[model samples]
Target chain A: MTHPKRVQLLVGSPRGKRSTSTAVGSYVLNLLKQKGLEPLASLWIGHILKSPEKIDEFLKAVEAADMIILAAPLYDDCQPYIVIKAMELLAAHQREQSTTQKRHDGKLFSVIVNCAFPEEHHPETVLRIYRRFAKDMGFLWGGSLAIRAGEALQGRQGKTLDDIGSMAKKVKEALVRMADSLSKGSPSADETLSVIPESFSHGPLSFLGSFFIWLNNRGWAKQAKKRGEDVNARPYME
Target chain B: MKALILNGSLEHQTHLAAIQEILEDELSKAGWECESLILHRLKVGTCIGCFKCWDTTPGICFQDDQGREINKKAIHSNLLVFLTPLTWGGYSSELKKAIERMLGLLHPDFIKIKDSYRHRKRYDHYPSVLGIAVGREKKDSEEEEIFKTLIKRHSLNWHTPKQKAEVFLDKDDDEKIRESIKKIVVEMGVRK
Candidate 1:
């Protein structure tokens, strides 16, 4: 019998465990496990940035994996800088390994990118970045899923997939389908998936969603006030 | 108008220093004040992606590094130029690190523009943006297309009306590159 593919999930959010990226990554990992693929490892790239030892370990994991899934939150219109830094390190490792006897090749790569913006299309640039990165790294592009209004689907304080509530049904179904395809040694279609119901993406409900975001801003302002910081401070202005 | 140029080239790319000198000379000659920052030399750390800049501190990053000062310069400038070598069809990691810290320039509030959600500007104005990338020996059209598209998308998020991107081969004529930058700066309305 052929061995099950070894998959590694790298969480690229700086928020680490508390990030929505982690919640989504965990959901995917669980689905992959349910599909009978052996999960080689799951790691938080953010934590790896601080320690050289962790980075080395991350490099080792990448070398051993047959499939790699990168889940991250979009920052400043692209992958977070920490994620880019990790890619740089990975590129360096690839270069070093190329000089040796063993050549790295043909690892399947996919991305799960989420952003605070309500429109799933907001992270298209980031998804494109991932596709290009995979090509440059010699990985087979497995596809990507971009989630919009990601914070609304999972709480900021590390909510599990089970705690995702009503949306859990659609999310789970989608992941299962994706896992099934991957387990068959082929990728699911390239597409964006949102945890938000279709009704929430358009019409009156979309307007309501905007209002909630505005309310969230008010909470941020209150927190700023409590911290004795002005919400409108422009320290850089001349 | 005051312009800030971030040189994101890693050390050992001596051509970038020459590129910086030419850019500053031309911009100054065009009657624009210019500041160029060599990012790798600065002690700016990578953004940890904490939302403290938006929530707790409100436009202030907690990291207490050169990034804070760079953020200040970025918001105050009338024009911002990103100069870097393309890495995987995107800005270098050094430049991305500096750009990531710029989240403090936007408020945490979400606002819809052109039917898409984007962060509301924290300040009244943001600088126009220009991207100048030095390509590797042979041109990769796919990489160039990705770079231009990414910059245009970034311009939308920053709400900058004046956005331009230009890529030059490493072996391209120095005079031509300088002329190209001068044309962009002039068109951006930085008057003498």
Candidate 2:
């Protein structure tokens, strides 16, 4: 039997030491290793992205990888600058160079955003920012894992959220399926990725309304209230 | 309204041009003079998160990064507009790091508080935000929902001017997106 192709996972975490992002990256790396496919994982910190050269180095790594999984923590409800910046540079480079040469056609792109609170709902709106980034760069999105912030490192050291167990089996199963797809060159199994759907829609009003409901249902409404907004009277889409 | 437009696209990728044209046209029609800072052409760095501006340094972050200059412009402007592209569901890292390093606006003086959380006088009041997230979405066309949520969340952070509007351009249709921009511009009072 042929050995599966090598996979490169780029981990984007603003948190330097002892982070939930690293924990998830470790888990994915281990699972891939257990499957006997060579997986290379590296961490990219946001603060270190000082110049275009640094961003270019990251794009090079992403180009070499068969699949890229972004393991990041939700900062201020979105991916930190390092991850976003890295993706932007990569996409730009691909677009600029596509006419001259074939850009990296890395089959899959995935994100595991570890947030402080994990709901049984969809990923945050901020994650949609990355979805747009991935789509522009022409990566076949492999889906995302919005694990409860704390659960990733429950057995280890550092902060862990309460709902890790709530989505463990489901998350693991999803990751396994994603890994298989990466090995086989197929679309990810999680077809209901919330971000991409909103990106390509013509119905802006309907999309805006649904997103407003989704945001309110999550802790965003409370945050808005904390900042002194009557969420009920003023609907988001309005 | 004197508006400044910052395009963050790299060389040859014309997406930034599209956004600039739409935004500039709307703002100019409203009689606003607009300027742009295309960040990809600028020299900048991420915020180190060192609290030097709060204690060690007065009215300055130790690092002489581009954030200080941008912050100055933001402070001077009536309506600070950021024409940033979405990266991983957030602002570009350059913009993000630049945003974090804006703590130079905070005063050097600080006071200890009672309960637990120490409070420093917030130096810079955030400007009214009108974020436009362009690109693809999941679930066929679900990215609009995500952009809408992003806009709402971002708006919550600001002391908004009673009313605001947002445009989510996930799909790459210039004409349709142009129409959306027109609508949002009217809501923002930039177009009569």
Candidate 3:
């Protein structure tokens, strides 16, 4: 009997387990496990960036996996520098292995990217980057899922996905479908996934959504006030 | 007009430095003051995804590293030229790290700009951005497309009304690159 396909989940957020990336990634992992495709290893790219020595271990895990899921938060409209650095290393390793071992040509790769912006399309640019990176690395591109306003999926700090009650029923179903697609070695038909409905994310309702986001800034303003700092201070100005 | 050119090339230092010198000379001849930062020489830590710059300190990064000084320079400049080698069809990690640390330049509040939600400008003025990407060799059509799209997206997020980008192979003519830089500076309203 063929053993279950080995899968590895790489969390690429700098915030580690406390980030929205983790929330979405954890949900996918749970679904994958339920489908009997348990991940062989789960690694954080941020920790590897801090300790270069850990990269070898990451590479070993990658070599052993039949599928890899890259879950990350968009930074400045693209993949975070840490994620890029890790990709660079992986590409270099593949180059080195091309002479001695079989290339990683058929391994499946997919992405789950989240952003602070409420619009689902906010992560589109980074998703494009992922597509390019996958092609350059010779991996089979299984497609991606972009989550907008992912931070709104509320739960305890490190255990956001454990409490799925905060997520809308439709969103939960969409995520399960995405995970199902991954298990079957195909891309998810669902393009954009979000807690906010499409109607609320665009057109006139989008104005109200922007207003709510702006209103959310009041928390930052209150913190700035408590710190006795001017919220509008131009500290970098000459 | 004051300009800041950040060099983010790792292997071709001599070639990148030559390009920088030519651009600086042309801009100076055109009566524009120029400053440059070699990013690999500085100590810049990766952004840890903390929003303290937006909330706690308000426009100040928590880390007091070279990135802080670079932010100050970027704010005061009229044009920000990013010189980088295309790493995976995007800017090198060295350059991206510096850009990530400059998030303090934007406010946490969201604003609708042309039907999309983006961060409000923390300062009244933002410098026009130009990305000059150097490839080790001739890039295929796909790499070129990805590079251009990434720069455009980056420019939009920086709130620059006019976004400019130029890609050059390592063996491309230095004179042509200098001419391109001069054209952008002139178009940005700098006069000799």
Task: Evaluate model 3: give its TM-score.
Answer: 0.92
Query: Whole-model lDDT for model 2 versus the true structure?
Result: 0.55
* Candidate 3 lDDT, A1-238, residue by residue in tens: 2333777889998888787677777778778888888687688899977665799889888888988888898888788888988897898788787575746676888888777676656677777778888887778786677777776664215656656574646556766887888788766663677666666667677666766676677867887889888787778663
lDDT by residue (A109-228, candidate 2, tens digit) is 777776543232324565566666667666767676666423334423433322365535555555677666655655554332222223222254545434533443444235435645
List DockQ, one per candidate, in order. Answer: 0.71, 0.17, 0.74
Off-target runs (Cα >4 Å) in candidate 3 are A1-4, A100-102, A154-156, A164-170, A203-211, B11-15
Q: Candidate 2 residues B17-83, lDDT tens each?
A: 7777878887777787776677666766655444445444434556776666676665444455555
CAPRI category for model 1: medium
Superposed by TM-score, candidate 2 places the C-alpha of residue A108 at a distance from the truth, in angstroms, of 2.7
DockQ of 2: 0.17
- Candidate 3's displacement at residue B44, Å, is 0.8
Top-down DockQ ranking: 3, 1, 2
Best model number under TM-score: 1
Q: What docking grade applies to model 2?
A: incorrect
Runs in model 1 deviating more than 4 A are: A1-4, A99-103
lDDT tens digits, residue span B1-192, model 3: 788999986644556787788778877888778998889889888889887898778888999899999999898888898888777668888788899999999988777788777888999888888887787777666666777787788788789756677777788887777777678767766653
Clashing pairs in 1: none
Fnat for candidate 1 (0 to 1): 0.70
**What is the TM-score of each candidate's chain B when compared with the real chain B?**
0.96, 0.73, 0.93
Top lDDT hit: 1
Q: Please, what are the lDDT tens digits per residue for candidate 1 over residues A49-115?
A: 8899999999999888888889899887788877988998898788787465333456778888877
